[model samples]
Target: MASPESRIIELASRIAANTKKLNDYLVANNLPTPSFDVKGPKANLVPKQEIEVQAARAAIIDDTQELRRLVLGPREYLMSYTHNELISQQAITRFGIAHSFPVGSEASFAEIATKTGLPETNVRQVIRHAINKDIFVEPRPGVVAHNAVSRLLAEDKVIHDWVGASTDDLWQSASQTCNALTKYPGSQEPNETGFALANNTKATVYEVFSQFPERARRFGNAMRSFTEGTGFELSHVVDNFPWGDLPQDGVVVDIGGSQGFVCFALAAQFPSLSFIVQDLEPVIRAAEKQPQAIELGTDRIKFMTHDFLTEQLVHGADVYFFRWILHNWSDKYCVRILRNLIPALKQGAKIVINDNVLPKPGVMSKWQEDRLRSMDLTMTELQNSHERELEDWAELFKLADPRFEFQGGELPKSANLWVLVAEWKGE
Candidate 1:
């Protein structure tokens, strides 16, 4: 039999190899690749980046083989549940293994175990493991407590399923111990089901949003924060665009325009243009009650209850606007949604999709790219949709409507999100 150290090294080597193979496959398929840059930019090659990459490679390969062993080899399924076990431990560290009280603070294992209804040994083990990962901390030996990262979960209100949750929150989208490719057993083209499993209802995402009402409200609240911090930059940056070139009054419509936030922002900048906001009934109801929105009166701004998938109600609008919406559906469904808008577009209508388009291969930093891809998986596992790269978006448009041609442009200077403007030119 192999020595223990030899086994460990072998496992790491396998992981590294697996990561590389999958990473290579993804690259070949024109998909996103997780960054494992072991070397920084160097002519002769650097050691640090190489080391990290090697480690990542080893982990991926070993994890994959271990997972295979659990499923296909003689190993019992007991260890197959490791990811789920980690998820449970993670939840305890965030939601309270002992009590829902502050984690990582000066709390004894006995007290925490009693509060959480977990075994004392299990509680101790979870806390100890969490501490090592910095999920929580030990102010002193045996005294564990939550830290700031853990505190994100310690909130009374569940803003998003991820609120106050540990890093395992990422796993809530799917409980699979192995990657989705291995879990679903060969159904791997990337669609809404996978996206939803990874995001919308991920235990962490659920922890953040809770239920539908709360989810909608928190979604708006999150966006509100994003707008406040980045709105000025976007407004100023987008304002420089040729709004004058867009259609006149009755030409542009904002789909899913909750509370007229985007319209309000745009109206302030372009006083001459008319705007229409279409959304769900509840959102429209809420928008009607906002003091400023109600105060704005209802002239050019008309609120209507329309579902984008059912039909395109806003006909002949010179432009259709969808902001941060498409990343929530499968490619097929997204194509369906885009096709639904076809009839509403006249000869020259433009569709502006203001959402984060995953960057082209190697264009973005690995961290950002991985973050987005992880989000894509999260969405697949949760709400059943995902963010797509520019090529994905363009191809989707072409698939849905051959008459429509996509044009990519540099988003306004302050815009963190990218834009893919689809123009319907085949009158």
Candidate 2:
């Protein structure tokens, strides 16, 4: 076996090799080199179908993370890595520094301060910190301009909302998580979460957000950004699943499908299939107002207000789809959601779940695993819920009712979310 130093050197070599591969792919494809400059390529989004590019990118990410860990060593990393970066990011976002800067044109620190009503000294400090993270750039002595990352924050409303929700809402909730755990030990109630504690509200995050529509909208937009990002494309669901196998004019009920986005994608592909998108009254109403919803045709796709926890009213549907829903609730509520569906699930009806499935220890790349684990903790903080492992998902169906055939799951290639299916064998 090689020594740790030797292993690190090997990783460094791999990193360089992969980096060159990625660079070559980009150049050969006439893709612009990755840069923080505002004028850099707009196609910065993850390569969807480019197999070689994807492999190179993945190798680079994995090797780079390992190399950094080896260089820092365990002790040094733990001591040096602090929450200061998060705090600095929060300050920049809260002060609207990214929004203040022009995309192509540079602005002096003083001008940014004036636009954002932040102190010039403070603006310089926060902006410089963000610059260190390659978010914004200082073109000259004290002038600031939008980098590509900062330009996205400035121009993309959904990305802006993502930052706002992450730094403001999620950060506050995370800060109070420990206190919440101490206060409400073993609590499973969503209302007893860190979010509730941070806001000093008895209501759950959703309930509180309901009272503050703008905040709710921002959070929704943040989720939209997340779903649209990288491997979370709706096309993955349309292509990876057996939607084409369903009978003509078969009903697909979308439980908690906020804007019928998934349905919209499915409808476009499986033209013979119809859909019922069920959500809260306001969400359903909002879905109805969308031009895409109208174009899909009301007869083909209908939006209805229905609380999923109570009972699923649409009976004998070919498939009941839950996308990014069950993970928000603890196992108890997840079971309840399943049990509620039983009344409507006809024999052999499919219960399809599209969500994160936590990987076993050391199975995934460190960077990818870290994100999944963070999401698991986030579920805990927000709703006392957690991301389930494959076994946990299987067990959930078993616990819901034995009559339900708990089919195994698959993580589709090029998809962020796992697609788990269970068939109902009516009792």
Give me the runs in candidate 1 sitting further than 4 Å from their true place.
1-89, 97-105, 155-170, 176-237, 247-250, 383-386
Report the C-alpha lDDT of model 2 over 161-204, residue by residue, as the tens digit. Answer: 88889988998899899999999999889999899999999899
Pairing residues by index, what is the TM-score of model 1? Answer: 0.65
lDDT of 1 by residue, 177-240 (tens): 2345455553423432333454633343334454556445545554454445442345643464
Q: What is the C-alpha RMSD, rounded to one decimal, of candidate 2?
A: 2.2
In model 1, the Cα lDDT at residue 286 comes to 81
Badly placed stretches (over 4 Å) of model 2 are 42-46, 247-249, 292-298
Give lDDT per model, in order: 0.61, 0.87
lDDT of 2 at 249: 84
> TM-score for each prediction?
0.65, 0.92
